[model samples]
Structures are given as C-alpha cells and as structure tokens.
Target: MLDLTTHWAGILSVIIFLSAYVLVVFEEVTHLRKSKPVMLAAGLIWMLIGIAYTVAGHGHETREFAAHIIEEYGELFLFLLVAITYVNTLEERRGFQVLRAKLVGLGLGYRGLFVLTGALAFVLSGILDNLTTALVMGTVILALGSESKRFVTLGCISVVVASNAGGAFTPFGDITTLMVWQKGKLEFLDFFAIFLPSLVNWLVPAGIMYFAVPQGRPTPQHERVRAKPGTLGVAVLFALTIVTAVSFKNFLHLPPALGMMLGLGYLQIWAYFLKRNGARRSDEDMVLDSFSQIQRVEWDTLLFFFGIIFAVGGLGVMGYLALASELLYADLGPTYANIIVGALSAVVDNIPLMFAVLTMDPDMSHGQWLLITLTCGVGGSMLSIGSAAGVALMGQAKDGYTFLSHLRWTWAIGLGYVAAVGTHLLVNAATF
Candidate 1:
C-alpha cells in the first residue's frame, strides 16, 4: 500500500531488530531474558510499518501484512508445537532416560564407547534438536568418564560437533534447517541430498578425536530408574507422528503440522487408555493430563521465535533484505556469498541470519540451498557459544568442558565444516 522501500521505516526496522538481537546475545551478562527485547521489537516494527502505511493512505495494508505473518509463520509455529509436544511427552515418559540407560549398559571400551556416543548423537540429533542431543550425550560421557577428566573433556567436544553436524542433514534436526524447510526453499526429500556430507561432518572430527579417548572400558554407575507404564507405546506413537508429518507434506499438499497435530490426537487417545488401566496416576501422563504437557511446550522459545520471525518479516517488507540480496548474491555470486554466509554463522546467530535470508528470498539452485543449510548448521560449532549444542554442553559439563576447552578443538571442527561443504559440492554437484 505504501512505498516504504526507501522510507525511514526501512531503516527503523533494521535498528530495532539488531538492537533486540544484541540484548539476546548478551543475555547472560545483562541477566535479562532475551525474549523480552525481541518481543518488543516485533511489536514496534509492526507499529512502524502501520504508521508508514497510514502516511501513504494505505493503513489497510497493515491488516494484510499481519494476516500474511499469521498464515505463513503460524504454520511453522504449529509444526514445531506438535514436534516439541511429542518430545516433551517422551520426556514425561522417560524415553530419553531409558535410551540413555540402555546406551550406558552397552559395556563398551573407552574408544568403542566414544564411537558409540558420537554415532548416537549424530543419528539422534538428526531426529531430535541438536542442543538436546548434545546435552544428553554429554552427560553420559561425563558420567562414565568422570575418573578421567581428559577423556570427559574430549568427549564433550565430540558431542557438540557431532550434534551440530548431525542436525545439518534433517529438517527437524536444527532450527535453521526447519526454517529452510518451512520456507519451501527445500523440500522434505531435498534434505537427503546432504546426508553423506553431514555424516562426514560428524565422522571426520570424530575420527580425529578417537585417539583422545583412553583404551579402558567404562564402569558406569547405573541408575535405578523404571520405565513408565506406557513408555514404549508413546515412543511408537512419536515415531508414527514423524512418519505422518512426512507423509502429509510429500503427498497431501498441506503443511506437515496438520498431520502432526492429528498424530498428537492419536497420542492423546493412547494416553487416555494407558491411564485408565494403569496403577500409577501421576498427572504427568500425557492423556490423563493433556493440558499439563501442552503447558510445558517451551513457551519462552516459541515466543522468542514469534518476535524474531515477525521482526524479520518487517525487515523483509521494508526492502533492506533486497539490498542484502544484491550485495551478497548478485555482486558476489551465489557460491562465495553462501560460503561467507556460512562463515558468519560462526560468530553471529544463524536464526536471524537464516530468517533474514528467507526474507531476502534469493533465487538459487537446490544445491545452493542445501549448501547454506549445511554451512550454517556445522559452522555453529566453530565456537562453543556459536550454537545451542555448544552452549548447552558448556553448562552441563562446566567442570572441564569450558569455553576454552571447546575452543581448543575449533580447528578440527572447522576442518570438518570445510570438508562437509566440499563433499556437498562434489556429491550433490548436480543440484548446485
């Protein structure tokens, strides 16, 4: 409605978005919640856009913009909602705990255990969020290797790298990949294109770190945890949910969230009967207490995304993204531009970067899209603070796996990143 392409509105949008991001990055020092600033930025950016529309006698355009955000972003929100909910349901059922217990019981020697842990993190991170995967596996490594601090430290590093690398190959593996998938830039099947590269991304550094793990076997102090009544059923249902989500997207011409929410319904029904016949009646049961699980849906994360996505959307409408597109892709060429984007992801958060790229809406081959996804996903491991996996591991194993400890291995991880990109260029050359 209004030509705010060159209007002050565009400049204002960038300022608000960046300011909010700075607060988020330093949230620890500030002792303030990152979501607070970003959420405010979203509201302010939208208000600025409304004022711009009013100035040009196009105030009605504000509603259309809001509708567009709701329709597009809402789909992503719902899809994540179902996935997160299913994961939380598993958490309630102690599926992760059970899996952790079984892993520890493998009676693996130190090097064998190291490989097992890294491999599990890689595969699980492809299905679970990388942060969660790293946290869980990092715990196992620290626990079993507690007598040997050096082994624990190196193992923590492997977990972070493996989690980040594993996340690069799947749609649900990392938030950046999810954004790429939700944007329709890459299809469900398109992710398989990078599977080998992602595997190399994990295995290369893992191979390097293998010698670091001592040759002794693990003496795990096993916990006395019992599986919940319906744990297996819920896990089966969770797997079904994932399959349904993929089916909906590939065959039904609908947002995968629709299929996932329906799967949630199946989980609910199973939960109901499990509760009806079971002896334990704790409220954490997903079916017996459905609202309880819904309440645990990481609202802070979802809200943080709400603000970030809306703010990024405002910038897209304001035209700064086009300027970026011209400078990065048009002038620099797609290959170099994408490679640089991946590099920046190490220092800067890739959430806003990927969202901005999605908003910029550049046109490129499918191969180029997968390349950026791999880069952004793996690049985050270059610094311990660069990714959720690294940051979470730092917190979980602070005694030895500090920021400096992780940084000590940056070169190796960085090499893995380069190899992954190279592999993509060679193996998926046709897509590019």
Candidate 2:
C-alpha cells in the first residue's frame, strides 16, 4: 500500500475537507445546501489523488482503490434511493398524515402524547430512517399540541433522542448502522442485540423530561383526513421490499441494493393498478404516480453521501485514516476510542465518522463493532445540530425546538448517553 502521510496531496485534501465541512455545519446560516461544498471537495481531492498517484507510477493501484470506493457508494446510494422512494410513496398516500390526524384526534394529554410520540419514533425509526421517523413523529407532536410551547419543546427533544436511539438497533434505521451491516461486520440479527441498550438510551432522558410536560389535552383537531386508495397495499409492498433486501443479504449472499432495486418493480406494478382504478373513479382517489414519488427522493442528501464517501476514501488512500486508527484504536484502545467516536458524532455527522472508521478498518471484536454502531447511531442526539432528525425538527418547529432549547436538556441527554454505554458494557459483556 502507498503511504502519503507526509505527501502534499494529503495535507491539501485535509484542508479541503475541513473547509467544506465548516460550510456544512453553518448551512442554516449560509442558506447553502450541505451537498454543494462537499461535492466540490470530493472532486478536487480525487483529482489531486489521481494526478499524484499517476505521476508516482501507481496508476493501477489508484484506479483499483477508486473503483472500490465507487462500488461502496453505489450500493448505499441505490439502497437509500429505494428506501426514500417508499417513504415518499407513503407520504403521497397520506399514510403519515392519517397517522398524525389520528393521534391528534385522540386528544391525549401533553405527557401522554410526549411518551407516545417518542415511543413511536423509537420503533418506527427501526424500519424507516431516523430523519423520516423524527419528521413524522415531530409533525404529530406539533399537531397534537402546537399551541403549547412547552409540550412542543419537550416532544421535539424526545423524538430526536428516540429516533436516533431506535436507529441504532437496526440496519435499516440509520446510515451508520447500514454501513456496519453492509461491511459484513455483523449479521442482520446481530443488530438486535443492542435493542435494549438503545431503548435505555431513549428512556432515560424521556423519564427525566416526562415531568416537565404541560398538563392537559391539546386543542381539539377534528379534521377528518383519510388514506388514499392502495395505502395498505403500498405499505405491504414496503414491508416485502425490506424483507427482500434482508433476504438477499442474509440468504443469497448478494448485495442488498439488488433486492431494493427489484422491490422498486413491486411498487411500480402496484402503482399501475392504482392508476387504472383511479381512471374509473370520478373522484381520482387512487391517482398516485409512483414515478413522481421517485422524483421526490432527497437527492441532495444522496449526493452528500456520494461526496463524503469519495472524499474520505481519498484520505484513506492517502493513509490518514490508518494513522487515525493507530492513534485512536491502537493507543487509546477500542472501548475508549469508540466512546470518543460517539461523542465526536454529537458535533459532526455520524455518516462520515462511521465511514472513516470503516475506512480505517480497525481490528475489533463483534461486541466492539456493536459498540461503535450504537454510539454513532445515538450520539448525534446530544445537540439539535448533531443529527438530521434534530436539524429537520428545528426547521419544522422553528419557534419551539430551537438549538438552545435542546442545549438546555443536554445534561439529561448526556446522562442517558452514559447509561446507554454502561448498559451495553454490562449486558453484552459476554459478546466482548
């Protein structure tokens, strides 16, 4: 392997990534998409690597590494695209809105709604990504009691914490978990081992914040929203799609993306039936076009993933990640080092942090791998800016769940974080 630890290309690549990341962190203030700077940095860094390695007469090795990175990004991209497409289809069918309406109609007390939304986020995020889970449950909380600032604040915090925690226990839940799974570090069922710890992570903070919820039912929301035709079928297809993906990975020993793409066909066929039925109905109740939902996938986020992978892969090829692995994993050891990785994730995006860890390819046990997965998944909840769920909720409920509001509860969240780590150490000690 080529070592570019002291190479000028390595130094310049570091500068480019850090500068782009600064823009990413300040994206709200700058009114710029997080994808733009990183995309540009990925291109520039890779271009430099191509040139440097080619001149050094290691063009073949460089090409092989670049191809490997491309393959990695491709699998993740297709899988997420399919997942987002399913989510968009559900949204179009009023699946989420109907749930929100039902919750609001229940007229649960502030505390009840808080626990319910948090719990739903915790469970739903295991199937859907944390961002979607947070958004859905956050909307429910807003509708359930938008007038109560106290309720909204507490509810938003809980949703963020729960969504991140829930995503930790399932491969489909968060980008970090998916990376670990796709890397073949753990089997599909192995992720469930952390479910208890993930639950404790959310429950601790929720129990502490429960008392602070305002008392009384939210203002009555009497709106009668209904699901579109084929809602149930679409949901079933989504479930089947997930099963197919897992089966492909676990049974067929194939790339999960292949199953996800194949599942896209199931949705298309279902959409055809809906369109044909809607044409016969005067009210156009079943008139969804699945292609439109495909267009609604979060392209910016997908692009951001592409850029981060390549950029980090470039650094890995330059030998920076190896140095990091030796310093963090080798010197501090996996337990402390993994804890620090999780803490750092509270400030940085967990995607890149996990990607860097994967790139480093440190030698660790199955329990240590699970430890990193749990930490990266939930660590982002310590601050509103730490996770996509928190950031989206901040935008969705601007006046209620501001950065300071979340920061105020950081101590409680931090306590939950520690408890989660301790619980895993105690309960999963046999695995270690």
Candidate 3:
C-alpha cells in the first residue's frame, strides 16, 4: 500500500473526514442527519485508498482491507440490529409506554426524576447498550413535557453520563467494552472489577449536578397504559438473548452477532405465536411482528455507525492509528495514554478508537486493558457529541439538550472521569 503519512490520498481523506465531522457536530443547527456526510465521506475515503493502492501496485491489499473492515462492521451491525429490534418490539407492545406511565404517575419532583432517570440509565445500560439505555430514559424525561427547560437539560445530561458510566463496566454495555472483551483482553466476570469505579464516575457528576435541578413535580399525566400480551415473555427472551450472546462469545467461541441473530429468531417465533393467537385487541397495541419492529429502528443512527466504522477504518488502513498508538502508548505510557484516549473519545467515536487500539495490539497488563476499556467506555460522557447516547439524546431532546448545554457541565463530567480512573487504579491494583 502507498505511504499515506504525506500522500495526497491520505491528506485529502483526512480533510474530507474532518469536514464531514464538522457537519455532524453541528447537526442540530444544520438540520442535517448525522449519517449523511459521513456515509459520503466513507465512500470518498475508500475510493482514494483504492486509487492510491492501485497506483502503488498493491490493489489487492486495498481489497483485503475493505473485506476486513466490512467483516468488523458486519458483526457490530448485526448485534445492534437484534438489540434495536428487541427494543422496538418491546415498544410496539407498549412496554416503554406502560413503564413511562408508571414513572409519571409517581409524581416525582424534578430532582427526584433526575436521580431516577440517571440511575435507571446506569443500570439498564449494563444490560442494554448505552445508546438504547439513553433513548429509553430520554423518552421518559421527554414525556414529562415539563415546561422547565432546565429540568429537561439536566435530566438529559444526567442520563447521558449515567448511561456511559454504567456501560463502562459491562461487556455488552458499550461497543468499546465489547471490543475489549471480544479481543480476549479481559474476561466476562472481570469487567465487574470496575463496577464501583463506574458508579463513582456517574455519581460524582450526578451529586454535583443535583443542586441545579429545580424542585416541584411536573403535572403527572395518568394514562392507564398497559403492555400487551407476551410483553413479559419478550423481556424474558431478551434476557435469554443476552445470555446467548455471552455464551456464544465465551463458550461457543463464535461471534456474538450469531448469538444475537439467534435471539432475534426467538422474538420472531414468539411474534408468530402472538400473531397466530391474534393477541392485539386494541388500537394502542401495534401488531407484534419482529420484521416490522426491525423496520422501526433508528436507521439514521445505524447508518451513522456504518459511516464511522468505514471512515475510521480507512484512516487506520492509512497508518495514522498505528502512528498514534506508538506516540500515545510508547512515549506517554499506558496509564496516561489510556486517560488521554478517554478524553479523545469525547471528541471521536470510541468504536474506532478502541478498534484501532485492538488492532495495534499493544503490550499491557490486564489492569491496563481494563483501564482503557473503562476510559473509552465512559470518556464520551465528557461531551455531548462524544458518545452515541449523547448524540442521540441531543436529537431526541432537541432544544432542551444541545452541544452548548452539555458543554456547560463538562467540568463535572471531567471530575467524574478523573474519579473513575483513580478508583480503577486503587481497586484493580491486583490486576496490575
């Protein structure tokens, strides 16, 4: 392959990526879907890579790189597809709506809801990915329809932080942790070592931000919403799916995506049974069809994942990430390097950043591996544009949560970031 360090193809690809990312960062103002520019950039960058490699008489190498990148993307794509489909299936069955009704009926004050939502986000993200956790909690926060923008703003920020911190300690929580786990850098149970630290990461900011939340409950809307038949079964199936995914990775030695797809089949079969029984009796319940549920997923967000993977993969193929790894890990050392990576994750997607680190396959202890996992997983909480959860919430909450709104509380999040790191060092010192 051609040397991309100073090559025209590399230079232009970097420019294209940065330009597209700028548009993505200002998506609220531009009214542009975050996926569009990155998709275009991914294609453009690959085209440049293809051309450069062909000119250098290494065209086949470009094909290999594309194949590898596609495989990586495909695994994540399928895993997320099943996860989103299940979430959608639950929503279609009025699962979230019923839950929302229950929470709203509580008539919790703003401060109470703030803690509740954040706490829920943290716990749920351990089972679901951070993005889904944030969206679920975000729905509840938005449902309040509270005229208080400050409440919405604080609630959204709290959820974002909680989701990221919560996901940091679980293999299935964040893509970064999943990548680390999949790479055999850490074991499944080993992730729990950082659980306390992750909790600290969330609680620090939450405790500090608690005072800012306004008092008084929003007017509770009491809708006697009930989940349809099989809702409980679906939840059970989802739990089984999580088990299947873990079993696939740990025991079967198969890709977790396959297990997720099999879990999707569990939903499909149940859906068929539900349809056979004609379970839906009211207008509130949507037909329980898994395929239709799949259709309801956030395609924009999925496509954004597609764009990010390809764009960053292209950059990795060009050698920038390896160079970065050497600079960060070799010169700066593992601890500081991991910390800086966390901060960078606030700027760049942790998926690609972790992917690059796994690809570089640096020598480090178990503690260091866990440290990077914790940092990358929660680092995105530092900025609104940092993680998928934050970005999705910004769009979901609209004017209530913006880049500037999230930026205003960066110091608190940064403190949480530092606290989490220190806790990890102290708690997991045995691993080192």
Candidate 4:
C-alpha cells in the first residue's frame, strides 16, 4: 500500500540509527573491531538505503542526497579533521605532559590530586571536548597508579562528570551542542544563559565526591622536565591556529573547517621548520613522536559520527521526524520533555537526538531552548558510556576503568543532573 511505503522508509531510518549505535557499543565493549571503518560502512549502507527508497518512491535524485550530505556536513568533517590535527600535534609535543608534571609536582596527597584533577578536567572540557579532557586527566591518574586507586577512581569519575557539565556551556564542547548550533537551532552565546545551571551540574557531583574521597598522604615530588627551548614557539603557533579558526567562524562566516585546515597546515610547517632548524635532539624527537601520535587519534568516533549523521539525514528525508516530533511534544510537553530527552541522552547518542529535536522545531521561547541545550549537554554525565569523556576514558584507561566502576558514580551524577535542572528552572523563573 502507498501508506506502507511511507511508513517503511521511516522504519528503515530508525533501524539505521539503531544499527550504528549497536556498532559503536560493540566496538567499545569488544575492542576486537575498529569503530571508524565499521562506522563508515554503516553510514554508507544507510545512505544507500535512503537513496534507494527516495529514488524508487519519491522520484528524488540520488545526487541530491550526496549534495545534501556535503552541503550540510562538509564543514563538520573539516572541523573534525582540523581539530584532530591540532589535538594530535599538541599531544605529540607533550602539551598534556606539562600539565601532568605540574600536578605530580604539587605533591598533593591522593585526595588533593583527586579534587584537583577532577576540577581541571571539568574546566578544560569547556575549551576542548570532554573526551580529550578525560584522556589527558585519565592518563595522569594512570601515571599516578594503584597506590592511589581510590583517589584515581574518584578523580576519573569527577572528571567525567565535570567534563560533561562544562561541555554544555560551549558550542564546541560537545557534539550534540555543535550539531544543534550548526543546524541554526541555537546561538553560541545563548548557551551561557544556562551557564549557572551547567556549573551547578558539576559542582553538585564534585562536592559529593570531594567528601566521598578518602584522605591519604601526599605523593612524593617528581622531577620536573625543563621546557624545551622551542616550546614557546610551538605554543605560539598553536595559539595562532586557534585564533585564526575562531576568526574564520565569527568574522568570515566560513565553516569551522577552514580554520582547522589552515591551522593544521601551519602546524605541519612549523614542525618541519623546527626539525630543520638545529633544534635539540630531544625536542626534535619529542616533536617527531608527537606527529606520530596522530595515528592514535580515534578515527572510529569520527566515522561513527558520520554514519549517524547520514542515518539521521535519511530519517529527515522520510518525514518521520515531523510526525514523531508532534507525538512527543503533545505527549510530553516541553518541560518534562526536556528532562526526558536529557535522561535518554545517557543511553543514546545525544548528537542524533539533538538532530531529531532540531527537526521538530518546537515553538519555544529562547529560555526554553537554552534549557534543552543545558540539560542535554550536562545530562551525558549520567553514565560512563553516555558521553565522549566516559567512552574515551574507558578505552584509553581500560586497565583501570570499567562500566561498573563508572556506574558507582551514577548517584553523584544524578544529584548533579537534578540540581542542574532545578537551578535552570529557578534562574529562568527569576529572569523571565
């Protein structure tokens, strides 16, 4: 029947989304398969299926889908490439090592390290993503070792919570926020409207963990490495790249990718010159190793994201999103709907959920949209697998962190989640 065909397309879109999520989870749990390739394959599969349905029934051109994918997501891909390149370059130069040495040198007791590391991860995540923040902090914790297992676990959980909470305030901090921004669903500074609430999300859990952490003796001071002679140059170059990228985004109306690409090129050139300019053997070696570290970048996450975008795009094309939006809005209403959506983000990827919401175009005031953004952004800390920080920490520090270990912190996260929502409602009520 004609009706059946329409419904089938919608069903296929959901199936594709679910399938990609399964692959992502499987990759995380098994570690037997690579996620990037699997994600790419899944994306292509859904794209093909979408094309088949569109062409067969709707008389849509296949090229239109491809064009849509490029036009809509091209900048995102570029931003990913550039961001990855920058992260890889800094990681290669031991950017994080400097921080690690400082933390260890603080001679902080186990409790101090736990609190400090968690706070740092939370703050840093506002600038970088939660995953990178977690990776850097988690690595530091791992370096600290089992002598501080309790502290390390507490620190990791705090970092996960803080990172997710902090990420909600910025456009670049989380994928869901970024997707929503890209779709013109929200503005950049508008996110800060809920900043107080977002901060509360981390503070609540962090405060709890602060008390939960056991006191221990201070760690012995570790030897500090002198900054390489050209460290300043590398740092400057890095700053310039970021500045240029931001300039492109704000002033030029260019895609975020343009800045990232320019930055990547600059780093490569800077590294080449540094290598050629009689740089010390140690500095040169560090730079070389840093370059190599790019290989370790999680390509799987990127591919998985790509697949999800396409699958969701397919759903958008099918008109199912509109109907689903109507049903959800009617049944849940915006206030409870926002909470339910945020909670669901713990199990499902918030990126697609954000996309689905964008498709829905709920008629809401700016404050309400801000609430949605804040809740979804901070809500990811609810579970270890809920956000990038959790997943990345799990993968990079598998020896120490497990899903169950993260689950132990759920009560703390839940408290934070509730506090964040409550704070947002209070702030909104007072303001409006």
Among these predictions, the greatest lDDT belongs to 2
- lDDT tens digits, residue span 270-364, model 1: 86787776535544433345556788997777888888888888877776678789999999988888888888887887887888777777888
Error of 1 at 71 (Å): 1.8
**Clashes in model 1: which pairs?**
none
The sequence of per-residue lDDT tens digits that candidate 2 reaches over residues 191-277 is 999999999999999999999998887777777898999999989999999999999999999999999999999999999988988
- Model 2 earns a TM-score of 0.98
Instruction: Report the number of the highest-TM-score candidate.
Output: 2
Itemize residue pairs with steric clashes in candidate 2.
Answer: none
Q: Order the candidates by lDDT, highest first — what do you get? A: 2, 3, 1, 4
Global local distance difference test of model 4: 0.72
Ranking by TM-score: 2, 1, 3, 4
TM-score (C-alpha, index-matched) for candidate 3: 0.92
Candidate 2 least-lDDT 10 residues: 279-288
- The 0-to-1 C-alpha lDDT of every candidate, in the order given, reads 0.82, 0.93, 0.88, 0.72
TM-score of each: 0.94, 0.98, 0.92, 0.87
Error of 4 at 173 (Å): 1.6
> What is the Cα-based TM-score of model 4?
0.87
Q: How many backbone clashes does candidate 1 have?
A: 0
